[model samples]
Target chain A: MSNGIRVAALEDIPEGEGIVIDKSVTGTADDIALLRDTDGSVWALDDTCTHEDASLAEGWVEDGYVECPLHASRFCLKSGEVQNLPATRSTCPHRVEVRDGEVYLFPNETP
Target chain B: MDADISRVVVVGGGIAGVSTVAALRAGGFDGDLTLVDTGEFPYDRPPLSKEYLAGRRDLKQIALRTPQWYDQQDVRLVNLTAVTALRPAEGAVELAGGRLLPADRVVLATGGGAARPPIPGSDGERVHVLREAEDADRLRTVLVPGARLLVVGAGLIGAEVASTAVDLGCEVVLADPVNPPLAAAVGIDLAAWLHGQHAARGIAVVPAGVESFEPTAAGIAARFSSGHEPRVFDAAVLGVGMVPQTALAVAAGLETERGIVVDTCQVTSNPAVLAVGDSARTRRDGLLLPRTEHWEAAQQDAARAAATLLGRPAPPATAPWFWTDRHGRHVEAVGRMAEADQVVIRGSFDDPAFSVFGLRAGLVVAAAAVDDPTAVRAARRMIDRRVRIDPARLEDPSVNLRALLR
Candidate 1:
């Protein structure tokens, strides 16, 4: 009955790290990557890298971008714009908000 | 001679060639640029042995650039055309059917073909080599479940094919002279683990070189150099190495040893011509460096070649990096492991993620990881930035890699 699924507490995600919201829970076609940048800002994007089947949730988050773990393709966490290749297509950005101390995920919605 | 160049022709459509064109356009080179390729479209080759062979990705999905990219970049797409000759004296490129195209400069990005060793009876119809998309397609048809397969050379390509074949339910026999290959590139420990994984996953690992092949009524029989009895296989694949495609350069009277010799700027012996990718080998200070046949190496060559042609400072060199994926495990290595005097591993080999760091004189020289690309990425930065690090901290799994950068 809720559009925003309360996934975790704000403290659940480490700074400059990402956690995956499985596809079944998010009700999306793919898993979602909830990234916490070094600046303490939270962002969400489809976890599956557009270039391949690699999970972006496992990528290295730094400087407002997430570098794919399999390949070094960096994606802008804010806009999901690909900053490099072997990945040319941008991942899908998602909307996220913090309510009280909980993080809410809006599936298939842009921030 | 202030770079009044206008028309340019690039031969080959591999990663090196595409990257060259992309880099040229990115660097504001508005000259008349043309890409002459032998394929219908430029596609990435790494997937040929993995995804494409597994029938997971098709030709279009593996394309390096889209159809709209050529038009957007204003690059003339001369598909299915091969440059027959490089007439540097007249600044012209001759194509098949005797058409001469005027060019101010020529970039030779022709990639290499798979090495076909002189093994007796190797030319049989059952013998195969994977290089082009067509080759992958042909290999795929025989990869049916339970088909007996003999893959020679336990290197990257051979191991990858063996892993893929096993996944497809094919009976895979992997043979190589070396007990565990890739030691110099990824260090000894990781190499052993990677090589040993084949046997644990339903693959027959043989420590012997192939002697010859004999076609029998039942598939093909292969004799081993170890004096083992002849084994029958439905098919066999050669994954030894690559032979540089330097015929055009040789016939054109350019300097070629193992590959086309180029200077710091990727300019070939002929000033009017340049070579990049596997077909190009760099000669610096009268020293010829070995040809790097990896995907990233080719891409890196593109950036350097563009800068050289545009008269801009070449991008600062970084630690060389490469990657391979097999058995659902992703492996990455940076720099040269052979340069290390000490090797320290982060986390256990059985862990989901582990990295081996190669250190020399308290400096991180190289690193290889199993499903831990972050560690390799951090290692690459440490190597490039020349950051001094303590091996103890690097080995501690609890220490975040970012702290090591300091």
Candidate 2:
């Protein structure tokens, strides 16, 4: 859907944590990974690892980088840029907007 | 002299050489820079053993950087050229064509060549070594399904080629002088498991030596020192090790021991010249450190070389780390695993996810993991920081590794 879909409330995702919103709108099963920064900012990206089929939601998030658990490739949550190897390409970034203490995930326009 | 450098010449266009050029530019060195490489482009080498040998990754995919990156960085990439001589006194490098280029500073990143041990019939047409792309291409041609292959030296390259060949439907026999090869690097227990993994994947692991090779009517027959019968194979590959390219440095009168000698800053005896990568023998605190051949070590060496050339502070040294992928599993090891007094293991090795941490006096000295990088990463941090850890807590899988960071 072009319109924003409410995924979770601010309290659902703690500071410096991530959650996988498995909505089918992104053309895959629960592919959107919503990350809440320590600064209380929410960002979204495709959950699938660019290097492998691992989930980014299970990865460790620190210093604005989401490191894949499988191969330890770190991806910048904000820009979806691959910061380390075993992965050469950036993952797809999803559009996210937060308002009224709720996180909304819009369909990735670039996808 | 204010260390005022204008033109910098880097020999060898491998990862170390490319990283040196890139690091120089990224570190804001806009001076005249030239990268002389023997190849058409700087390409990654690890894939040459596995993916490239398996024909899974192409040259374009494995290239370290696009051709445009050199042009954008204004780095004069002199491809298909080799430095014949190093005139360090005059700060000049002589290319193969007898062209002399003046350089305020020189970085030697000439990497290494595959060591071809002298064995009877080792020079045969069917025998090969996987060092360059051309070598991998040639091996790929003979690695068809139903092909029989004998790979010598069960180290990383040999094991990788054996795995790839097995996946390609080739009958593989990997032989080394010692059982469970790479014990010194991966520790004895893990090396045994790794050797077992190869055997489990339909590849034969032999603890013996190839006494000689003879070309038979059907294929190449290899005589083993283990008293086994002469085995025939379609082809053979050598993954023994690397011989550092240090002849040019030696001829140039640079102090060399094992490799081109360099101090902690990666500067040769002559400050105007520097060396990095497999060819650089580093000395720290008046002790000559062993030259590392891993890809990440090369990158780190290049960074230090660039910093030394730029007169900038070298980055804090981190514990040595390396990784290898085999049979669809990723293994990473950090620090010195060989010298640990005790090995604390987390997770069951029988199960797929496990990490073995080498402890010395309650501190993590080294660690190796199979499919579990979280432990390796934490172990690296603990080792680097010299953090005292409770081995009991380390052995307990229930204790979170990150919690130890605090």
For all the predictions, what are the DockQ values?
Answer: 0.55, 0.36
Worst 10 residues of 1 chain B by lDDT: B1-10
Off by over 4 Å in 1: A1-11, A23-28, A38-40, A95-111
TM-score of 2: 0.92
Models 1 onward score TM values of 0.94, 0.92
Per-model TM-score (chain A alone): 0.93, 0.86
lDDT of 1 at A79: 94
Please tell me which predicted candidate would have the highest lDDT against the true structure. Answer: 1
Docking class of 2: acceptable
Kindly list the per-residue Cα lDDT of model 2 for residues B1-406, writing each as its tens digit.
1357989999998889888998898888989999999898888888898777788889878787778878998999999988999887787999998999999899999899999999999999999998899999999999999999999998888888888898899999999878878777768998889889988998887788999999999999999996977899999999999999999888888999988999988999888789999999998888998889988788889999888877799988888888777788878889998889998878887997898999887788999889887788888889999999999999899987867766
On residues B1-406, what C-alpha lDDT tens digit does candidate 1 reach at each position? Answer: 1276788888999999999999999988999999999999999998998999999999999898889989999999899998999998999999998999998889999999999999999999999999999999999999999999999999999999998999899999999989789999999889999998999898988899999999999899999997867799999999999999999999999999999999988999998899999999999999999999989888888888888878899898888899998988999999999999999999998876899999999999999999899899899989999999989999999998976764
Q: Please give the CA lDDT of all the candidate structures.
A: 0.91, 0.86
